[model samples]
Each structure stands twice: as C-alpha cells, then as structure tokens.
Target chain A: MGDLNTVVQSIINLPPAVILALGALLIPALPKRLRSPWFILLPVLALTFLWFLPVIQLSDYCIVAWNYADYSIMPYVSDNLSRLFSTAFLVVLITGGLFSWHNTDSGEKIATLFYASGAVGVVLAGDYLTLFIFWEVMAIASTWLIWGCGDVESGDVGMRYLLYHVLGGGLLLAGILVEVMNTGSIQLQSFAGLSGSDLLSNPGVLLILLGVAVNAAFPPFHTWLSDAYPKASITGAVFMSALTTKSAIYVLIRLFPGMDILVWIGLIMAIYGTIFALMSNDFRQILSYSILAQLGYMVTAIGVGSEMALNGATAHAFSHILYKSLLFMTGGALLYSVGTNRLSDLGATLKEATDQDPKFASQSRWLFGFYMIGALSISGLPLLNGFISKPMIIEAIGEAHYEIAMLILIAASIGTFLHTGLKIPYYTWFTRDSRSGSKPLKQSLNSKASFGEIPVNMNLGMGIGATLCLVFGIAPVIVYDLLPYNVIYEPFRAYPIAESLLTLSGAFFIFIWMKSRLLTPGVLRDLDTPLRATLPWIRQVFVDFPWAIFEKAEEIVLAFTRMVIKTVRNPLAWLQPYSSEEESTSTHSTEAFTPAIEIVIGLILFTSLVLGLFLIF
Target chain B: MINASNSERMNQSSFFTRLPLWIAILAAAVGLTLEFTLLRGYASHWWNHVPAFYLLYGALAAIALLGLSIWGSKVLNRQEAAGTNEKEA
Candidate 1:
C-alpha cells in the first residue's frame, strides 16, 4: 500500500480531460483510416491511466492543485467518488467510438472525445475554477458534436443547445466570481444552508447550483437535451447519452448533498422525465427524457445525502451511462437502417432486418436482444443493473427517512418502464406498420444505404454495454467495492427485489391495458416557450414605440442579441438575414454603416440592462 | 394447444420476435411467489413488508404520475410540426 501510494504520488498527474482533448485535436489532422482507430484508442488509453490511479484523500499535492497567484485550482482528483464516475465516462466513450467507427467522420469523433474529456475533467476537478473551465469546454464540444450531424435542423438545434449551455456557463462564472470575492477561497465545496457561503443566504452559491441544474436537466431547465440530442448524428447521440448530465449529477452529489430542496426538485424531475418520455415521437427523444427521469433518482439520492444514498447515486450513474449509451446506439442503428428517427419508421427497418434471408436474421435478432437488455435493465427487472442500483437508492432514501420521496421514486420507476422499458421497444422495434407518419422500406431505403445488418462495430459497442449491465447485476460488489462509501446495502435481498418486481408487474398490467392511450407520440413543451416563441413576439414592442424610443430600443435589443450572437450564432442569427447577395448589394449602395454611434448606444443599453438584471435576479 | 407441424412450430419460437415482456412477466411471477412463500423480504422503511405493499404503493404512485403526466401532456404536448425552424416566425 505504501509503495502504491508513492507511485500514485510520484507520477505526473495530468488531468485525463487534457490528454483526451489534445488527442482529439490531433485526430482531425490525421489520415482518414488513422482517425477511426484513434477514436477507440484515445479513450482506451485515458481509461487505462484513470484505472491505474489510486484513491486520493486530503493530500493537496497528490490531488493536482495548481496555484495561480492567490487561487488554488486543482484540476485532477482521484477520490473514489470521481474515480467511479471517470471509469464509467471512459467506458461509454470507448463504446460510443466503436458504435460510430464506421458511421461518423473525424470531426464528430473529435468533438465526442472533447465532450467525454470535459465530463471526465469536471468529475476530477477540486476547485470551482477547474470545474468551470471544463464545464465551458463541455458546452462548446457538445455543440460541435451536434453541429457535425450535418443537417440544417441539427444546426438549429445545436445553436439552441449552445445558448442554454452558454447561459449555464455564464451563471456558473458569475457564481464563481462572487464566491471568490466573498469567501476568498476557491475550493469546490458546498455552501452552508445559511452561513459560510450558505446557499440560502448567498445568491452566488444558489446561482452555482442553478447553473449545475441546467446541465443536470432539472425540470424547467431541461428542454435542451430532448430538443438537441435526438437531432445529433448516430454516434454523437451515443457519446452524448453518457456525459454532460451525468457530470452534472456528480457535481451535485459533491456540492449539494443533503440539501432537502433537492428531494423535491428530484421528485419533480423523476415524474417530469417519466411522463414526458411517454410523449415523444422518436426513439432517441424518449431515451433523452428517460435520461432526465433517471438523473432524478441520482439527484434525489444526493438530497438524501447519507453515505449509502451517495453510493447509490454514484453507482447508478456508473451503470446508467452504459445502458443509456447502448439504448442510443440501438436507436442510431435503427435510424441508420431506416433514414428517419421517428418511431413510425421502425416497420420499414424491421422488414429489412427480419422477413428476409437467414443472413439478415442474425442482425435484427441480436439487435432486438441488445435493445431489450438496455430496456429491461432500465426497467429495473430482476437480474439486471437497474434492479441492482435503482432499489439501492430507494432503500437508502427510505433509511434516511424520506419516505414520501422514496415512494415517489418507486412510482417513477413505473414511469421509466412505461417509456424506456416498454414504449420505446414496442414502438421502435416491434411496431411493424409502414403507414401514417411512417414511410415504407422501399421508399426509405435506397441501394447505397442499407439496414440489412448493423455493422460489427455497432453490435460490438452495444454488446459490450449489454454485457456490463448483466455483469454488474449478477455481481453488485464489482460496483460496491469501488463506491466512495463503505458497502452495507445489498440489492439482492428478498424484500427489495420483491418490491421492485411487483411494482414493475403491477405497472405493466396497466401498460398492456392502456397501451393505445399511452403509445401516441406527442411533443412536450416547458418553460422555454416564453424564451423562444414569446420573446420574438415581444420584440415587436420596439416596432410600436415612439420613433426616438424605437431607435434606442432597437439598439438595446441589438446589443443583447449581439451578446447572444457571440456565443450562439443561430436562432438570433436568423433575425439578421445576411446573404452574400445582400452584402454585395449593400456594398454598391450609398448608405454607409456607422460603428461609433451604434457602439455608444449599445454601451448605454448594455450597462442599463446589466444593472436592471442585477437588481432583479 | 392443437399440434402443428414440427417445422411450423419451430418457426414460432424465435427469441427475436418477443422477449422483454415475457421476461418481465416471468420475473414478476417469480418475485411474487418468492415473496409469498420462501423469501422473507426486508424493507428500509416501515410498513414495506405489509401484505402487497409493493403492489399498492407502486401502483398508486405510478397511477398518480401517469394521471399527472396525461394532464401535463394536454398542456405540454405539441404537434409534430412544432419543431419547425423558429426563424420563419
């Protein structure tokens, strides 16, 4: 043990995020064939490095804290809490790379590596600055991943995704600045309830939690995930399912454990994700909502904040990354096979998979098998990972005396089943009608692109994920021993397993009986409506004001739009229609564009808006 | 339960055509039986081991959420075309 500690301490501790990010940078410049192999290799190397790291505790030097003037920024930590999550992050990255190996281009793979690294970086961060830097990297990298999907729709969704994250990043930066100013310490620890950087009294800490909530996909702040994730490329969505939100859950566990408000927030999220998941039209969209519901369990566990609850939260995150990524990979396979991602398109692909020669049968048969592993595991069925981890959280929270919260989570699992476990598979793989909102196989599948057999790499990616779900379910200790908390909770005990099984049983009867009512694909809207549709309508206020006021109002709106434009170029970019033809025409015109006068007006509006927002928020 | 040809019957048994729901049903029955007879299940909180606690609580909570989600879907659910580009508006 002493020698091991010495080895861990002596080695140069580079943050795994940096290694992956630098590796990603080199990939785009590499030859095409070299790029595909690097996608799998980089994450494998990072995981190996992360696996070799020993458990770190209370030691400043070994934790990789760097000093910049008065600020102590620790970019890497090797505590069990971070190690547990980092292990999962690398696992999904490897799987996602394999899933994408044959399908995606170098740019998409590069963004995925960076996104994974950002998540790994945030998990290991020991200070707020370190956390914030990686948090911003995640914001940009994930947006790039979405943008690389190569569709105008994805580009539009990518911009919305970027805007939400940038706002989240802005909030986090504001919180960090205030925290440093008021407390004079940069350590990444939770504020007290009402004193010593108390979130209750301290607006800064509250802001920081809100910032994390956006990434965690807490209800009302969660529309971006469902809106953008489904639009990303096959592999992009797979990489996405593993990171961002899970990293947010890690930060929440670290920073806001035992805060009672999280219990309520979590319940809302659990119910919210469960319900909304059932309403989506696409496979990935439902899974995206399922991700929200699942994160609710983790968030709720963090709120319970006992050692057992934290352990359950972390363990659940570790398991969820694999299953969810597999779910997305299956969705990607279906999407690649059938062209469109809508649930109605499954019949077109299923016919191409089955009902064909024996050769094609092996592919869809295994594809269905892999998809079910993810679905059953997510549903918390017996002898699967969800059974192992989901009930552990409920038992822990119940032990912590949050009975109502515990019961709500138990109930929410049914919702998880309704969508992810039941609806997604039934509709995506089982529904065999190429009618009404669905196109037939002949129309959808051309000779060039086929869904005959999922590529070996995609199958391997999903197969590994499914295998892990089964492995961890059969042997809970593989996860338990690695938990930050000492293990006492056992998932295989009779009563908890009985309770989970019966609950799934009872809810399933309702599913079979109420199948038609529940199966319809409907879009679920949230608080973001006011920001998207209502905001532009309200922009007409500038049109009706006094001429003098109108000019100034346009400047103010322009100033704010410009700020938003700096971070997000679309959505608002459409407000200014600048084509090359227009630019050329304007160049030939006598009208001169003035910069100084506009700058003065922008400055005044910018200052006032900031003052107003500061006073209001 | 009438007999079909061997090859005809063999064709009906593919694992691909159906599996998850059956496994769910199988697990549920097994769990229900174990809880009823041999296995004495434990609960972290009070009243968890009472007769049919899992069935009742889980059912109630699921129903409540389902009801709430249905109501929410009325307000929250949008048309398929709702995702059209915002720039047009």
Candidate 2:
C-alpha cells in the first residue's frame, strides 16, 4: 500500500496530459484578445509542473511468477535526465506557442497540441513501449501539420513525408520488439556497457541502433525531411524544425552513446547536408538541410561519447530548437508578406521603403537583423548560443583524437557559414535588382506597405525565439546547467573562446571575399535534381514506352485475331481445303487415317504395357 | 520540317526515340548478368550484393519491347516523311 502511494504521488506530480488535450478546446472559447495569452500560459503551466515533479523510479506493473493477481501499476519519477529533457521540451513549446499567437487556424492549434503531446510523451516515457507509442504519435501529428499546408504540391510532399516517417517508425518498433524479446525488459536507459562481442551475442542492440539511426536522419533515409519540411506551412515548419530530429538525438544520446559508427555517419551527414544546402535556392529548403547538418554536429558529439561531448550535445539540442525555429519563423514572415520565396525574385524592399513608412522598413529590417543573429548563432558566431554548443563538439572531436572527423566538422562549419549565414541574407535581403523585370520596385513596395508588419502575435513568437537565441548565446552557463549530464568543462574559458572567435572571423572574411567576387549566390543543382527533373523524365519515358508497346501489341494481336476470324468464317476457305481434292483425295485420306489409327493403337499398347508392368510388380 | 526526306528524318528521330530504350536495355542486361554471377557468392558484401536477377531480366524484356515499338514508329515516320517530301517535290 505504501508503494502504491509512491506510484500515485509520481503520477500526480507529473503535469496533467489533459492540459494539452483541452488547450485547443478552451483557447477558442476565450475572448479573441485572451486567446494568445492563454496559449502562452498553458505551456508555462506544464513547465511549472515538470519542474516540480519529484525524482523517483517507479514500476507501473509488477508480476510474480507469471501470476495475474500480483500485477499492479507502479509510478516512478526516475532521474534528473528525464526532467532535463522534459523541461527543455516544455520551454520550447511555451515559447513556440507564444510565438504563434497570431495563428487563427484551428488546424495549427490542434496540430500544435498533438505535437506537444508527442514531445512530452517522449520525455516522460519510462519504457521502450511507452516511448515508441509517443514516437509514432509525433510522426502522425507532424504529418497532419504538413498536410495543413493547403496546396496540391504540399499534399504530394506530405504523402512522401508520411511514408518515410512510417518507415522510420516501423524500424523503431522492430528494434523495440527485439530488445524486449531478448532482455525480457522494456526499460529505456543507457546501454553504455554493451560491447561488440555482446552486440554480436545479442542482435537486439543492432536493431535498436538502426531504429534510432533512421529518426536521426542518418544518410539515405534523410530525404523525407528535406523533401517535406520546406513544403509545410510556415508555422508547421517552425514546429517541425524543433522536434523530430532532436527527439532522435535525445534517444541516441540515451541509448547508443558510445557507438563509433555514429561518429563517421555524423561526419558524412554534416558534409552532405552542407554541400546540398550550398546548392539550394528555396528559403525553407536551405533551413531544412541546415537542420540535418546541425543535427550532425550533435550526433558526432554523441559519438565522441565523453562526458563533455554528451553535455555539449544536450546543450546544443536545447539551443538549436530555439534558434532554428526563429530562423524558420523569420523566413515564414517574409513569405507571408512577399508573394514569393524564391531568392532571385526577392530584393532589399526594406532598404527601398520610404522613411515615412515607419512600420514596413523598420519591422522588416528588425526581422532581417534578428534573422541574421539567428544565422550567426547557428554558424557558431562568438557570444551567441551556437558559440557555446559548437565548440564543445569540436573539443570532443579533438579529445577523441579523430583527426579526419574534426577536419570534416570544421569544413562543414565553414560551408554552413557560406550558405546559410552569408548566402541566405545576402540573396534575400541585400541583393540588387533581381526582381526588376517582374514588377516596378516602387509599386511592389507600395503593395507590401498595405500588408504592413506581421500580426502582433506572430511578431511576439518570433521575438521570443530571437530573444532566447541571444540569451542562450550571451549566457552559456544557463544552458550548460540545463544539460542532463554533469558539466565539468566550462564553455567560457578564454583560450577556447578566442580560438572559436578566430574561426568565426575567418569564416566571415571568406563570406565577404566571396560576395566581392559575386560568388555568394547562384543556382546550383543538387540531389533533388534527380527527383525533380530526371526521375520525372524517367517516369515519363517508362510510362510512354509501355503504353506505346502495349498499343502496338494490341494492334498486332487485333490484326492476327482478325486474320484468324476471316479464315474461319469464310466458307470458301474451308471449301478450298487440302490441295486439289480430286487429285489428292486417295493419298491424303490414306495418310491422315493411317496416322490416326497408329496413334490409337500406340495409346492402347502403352496402356497395356503399363498395366502388365504393374501386374508383374 | 514535316517535308524532310525519309532518311534524314529517320536519322533525326532515331536518336531521340530509340536511344533511351537502347540504353535502358543495355543497363538492364548488365545489371542482370552482374546479379546472377556475383550475388550468390560469400565474397560479396551485403551492402554491395546485387538484388534478384529476375527484376533486371524483366526490365530488359520491357525495354527491348519498347525499343522494338520505337523502331516500328521510326519506320512509319520515315514512310510518312517520304510521302510528304514527294508531295512537296
């Protein structure tokens, strides 16, 4: 009975799941002015509950000797790590929800609720079974959000997106099943001691690693993310930018922290993402690719598997969810105002705005500036959130003595600066007269003036995300504390900070040099070219080819059938049978009748032979 | 353009119409032969091992049939082109 009370206490201590489930229902019932505030308040409440929850490990069910009577629900509040992830997740949800206060659509509201639910479920799940259930819920909910993009193209992308996630989910479930079957336990915890020999001895570990790898966007399986993310609605993309990959990273850190394959795989993904991003033309697509690249940094850190590296990965994940979301939100705002997202069609409308039009130019510039800050943070610019997290990873790579991995990580960082930090801002905000032919600059600017600044609630969302980016950047200690692992290494040591600063300054100089050379922005094709251009061409070739062949075959078959019918139906054809009947009748009849008689005699003889053999046996 | 001579028009359309199928068939055959020879051996790594050969064979057959159809179309087009050229002359 005392143990039951302990379980009840843990359950009660955890935030009510009903809060998120009922948030959408209650938000609309409130006055329009109060809606956004309430949305903001709900996540804060959840965060508060998360913070207050007592740390204790409890089992929900205990069975003795396979007896049904002893089964009981045991509640547990296990450790600080669960609290750390749950707290950060709730904080992101609160900030993101507040940021999206101006979104009036019920689709966003419901989807956001489910999305939050999925994240919370991941953070709180005690067992592999519980974790998987939430993992799939997250996939389904995010897909629904992508489907809310309200376009035919988005619909197509959404279906592909769902297929990939389902595949990942299936892999994850298979891994879980294997682990449960092998271990007779479903607990989700560190498998640090598992060795190569042990892994070979038990195949379940490999299955679990494969499952985690898919969601981590390990190469080849990563296409779905880049495919669907850019196609989502702006708000939906923001939510997506934060959750799925980060959850996978969290799971990897939790499960297979020391696996050496992760190191190489992470390096490959980072470079691959960066190179493709360099080639991308779309605004959100670049961000999507950047997400993969950024996840690579964390994954590599996890691969390093030292205390400092794990902490770095954890802290980086926290900061990334904030800054990346801000960048996406900024891009979304631009898309919302201007009719197009293509860089070649966008120009410095902010600079062109009349001083009299305070709102348009001022707000635009501010958003653009905030976006640059977010970019810098992601680029590992000094005195920002990225500065704190990225160096930790670099240090870990160095500590692990992986020279090639370190080199790749550094090169990828430079590439990130080249594409995202420099190219994105220069092309979208500062470039000269790209849209000259489409519309008169003044007229287009005037049309944009009418749309004015983004709605206040949207601005608030972006503002909150941007502020967190700066806060995390400026104060590394706060983020460092939030990490699940104990951090003995400091982010603010003068030598490391100076080194990172030098690297970033070098990257900035390179960006400026490239811009001077007019090499910052240009159309470069990527892997997507196959699907976008070549695959369709291939499909067209196949489709047309098969149709033509079938059509020709149909024609030939029709002709042959016609000829056969003509011969059969014509009385003259049958009547004119067998060469000159008068001349050959005697010989032809004798030949045909003789063969028929021989066949009949042969069958009778063979039957008799078979019967005689059977009788003898 | 439509009044071009038969041989000239056939030369032009043959490259566009027949080349893709020819390439596809050649690729399919190579793929099939590679799978049949290599995939059954222990020396082949799992990642590099070829998939079932039947898929390649089927692809080759489909492409061959397609090539034949294209060849037929080219012949028909040449005849039409000749007739048009004669009318023009």
Return the TM-score for each candidate structure. Answer: 0.82, 0.69
- In model 1 chain A, where is the ten-residue run with the lowest total lDDT? A571-580
Write down the C-alpha DockQ for each prediction: 0.27, 0.01
What is the number of backbone collisions in each predicted candidate, taken in the order shown?
A: 2, 8
Off by over 4 Å in 1: A1-11, A53-61, A192-200, A356-358, A438-447, A538-617, B1-25, B38-50, B58-76, B82-89
The DockQ score of candidate 1 comes to 0.27
The TM-score obtained by chain A of candidate 2 when compared with the true chain A? 0.78
**Highest TM-score against the true fold, candidate:** 1
Question: What CAPRI grade goes to candidate 1?
Answer: acceptable
The model with the greatest lDDT is 1
For candidate 1, the lDDT comes to 0.77
Task: Encode model 1's per-residue lDDT on A194-281: one tens digit a residue.
Answer: 3223566888888888899899988788999888888877778888888999999999888888887888888898887887787666
lDDT at A373, model 2: 80
Per-residue lDDT of model 2, residues A1-617, tens digit only: 99998677655465433456567577657777776667667777776665554433233221101212332222223345555666666666776776677776766677777777777667666567667877887888888888886666677778877777787778778877887776767777578766444666667777777676777888877887788777787777888888888888888888878777778888888877876676565678788889889988988888788888888888888878888988988887776665445455555443333123445655766677778888988988667888888878887788777866875686677667666777778776566455524344443332533434577766777887888888888888876776767866666654344344434444444444445332223334334445656656776798988888999999999999998886567545343324344345565554334233456678899999999999999
User: What is the C-alpha local distance difference test score of each model?
Assistant: 0.77, 0.66
